[model samples]
Target chain A: MSGADVLLLALGAVAVGAGALVVTTRHLVRAGLHLVVCLGAIAGLYLVLGAELVAWVQVLIYVGAVVILLLFAVMLTRAPIGPADDLDRAAWPAALVGAGSGLGLAALFVSAYGWRAVEVAEPGTAGLMGDRIFGSWVLPFEVVSVLLLAALIGAIVVSRPDIGAKDAKERAR
Target chain B: MIRPVVPFVVAALLFGLGVYGVLRRRNAVLVLMAVELMLNAVNIVLVTADTTVRAAVRDAGLTHTGGVFALFVVVIAAAEVGVGLAVILQLYRLRDTVVVDDLDLDAEPEGAR
Candidate 1:
């Protein structure tokens, strides 16, 4: 195996392991921390795969914004900092399905592309990504901005019950 | 050259773990974290496919489709988390619990009836 292949495999191991911990760990905050590790490893995977922009974006968004938001939610909800016994439900069914699908897909991938090696492409730098985004993906980019706006408004509206209550009171008057 | 299947298998396992977390976790925030896991798995697949498949199809019109899609997925994930957390907070306010199992869709709110 080439150095890149070894690196890819190692990083993938770290990612999957951390992801497992994220799900199974009883500590709510620890789960968020584990998610940070998992996402960082995946960002490394993206870098190895020659997607520099996507890798950094993963780091910026997933590891930075998303994980922080999750940790904040955990704190706001008053979840236990230490391990909690009631975090998980029965294990058998979840384990059965998880293992079945994971192994099944792994087997399928192994069979379909057994030992096949592919040449690595040029790394996708920000300049190239920008060109593509502004060139062909501008419409979708605008749509995403709109989506973000809507999500912002929706979140604000959903979290504050007084907004709805005020409107109802005004209508009743 | 890296075997393309390596990343594929990793993504598959990650997704499976995500599924397990979603089903097994009682906390809604934890469930959202699991969903993020699944989204990351998909991003891995997309980035890997962009690398391998683009190498093969050198002259394809849209060479960065997968990477672009992965970017869009990231944006969508951010939005989803924001809205999701808001809803979760609202639920916590109303019911004082974030346990997924405790949520009953069929039942009306105590005052609604």
Candidate 2:
């Protein structure tokens, strides 16, 4: 057990804790902040693992781009930032039971496969990762770009007032 | 002395807490946060694997797929945030609310069920 590992474990704990709070809370704004904390932790874990490229990606993509986009959308909608919104319903028992099973299943999977040790290679930097991503997974990588484009288009269509008018035109009797 | 196990345990615990939050919270935004938490927990494991696994059988000089997988996850997370927020925005416009409890596609309107 090295000092690096211990620090990571503790960071992981804090990250998880903050993330859970993000979900459980009723305030959407707070939820976004918590997500930042969670993503930050993941970045830390990436650094600890010696996957520096991945660590930076986590921060750049998640913290920098994704969360910022989320905040923008939230602000665009002008979501009531106060604690007025109801976070959950009265189905606490069912929710608890479902979540418990999810944890149980994950634990079972870990126990089943965890005992077997897999070989690990040394970690590399951004240059190595770039070669691999651009080399090995180029096809799926390009396809995902198209997919994201489609989603962006879909979002625009769904939210634009013109779409609403078009829907009304179709529905007009 | 205690290294791998602590981080691993912490990751698992984070995953558990994330699941609990997702199941319990009706807020869509919060649900997304929980999902992110779970993803982070997985990344922890991926990182641990990268650092800890024996160096011989692993190929490409990186033990775990941490770098590769994390990179993809980042891309996917971007797309997810984009699409998810768009949907949420549309829903808010229609219903004037962001509460997940208020959303129901199965209620079956005349045009779209």
Q: List fnat, each candidate.
A: 0.82, 0.47
Residues B1-113 of candidate 1: C-alpha lDDT, one tens digit per residue: 88989999999999999989988999999999999999998998888888878866756557877899899999999999999999998888777889989998786556420
Top model number, lDDT = 1
Off by more than 4 A, model 2: A98-121, A163-173, B52-58, B61-64, B104-113
**Pairs clashing in candidate 1?**
none
Candidate 1 chain B has its poorest 10 consecutive residues by lDDT at B104-113
Q: For candidate 1, lDDT tens digit of each residue in A85-168?
A: 988899989988988888898898889889889988778889889888998899999999899999999999988777778677
Location of the lowest summed lDDT over 10 successive residues in candidate 2 chain A = A112-121
Q: What are the iRMS values of all candidates? A: 1.5, 4.0
TM values, all candidates: 0.95, 0.81
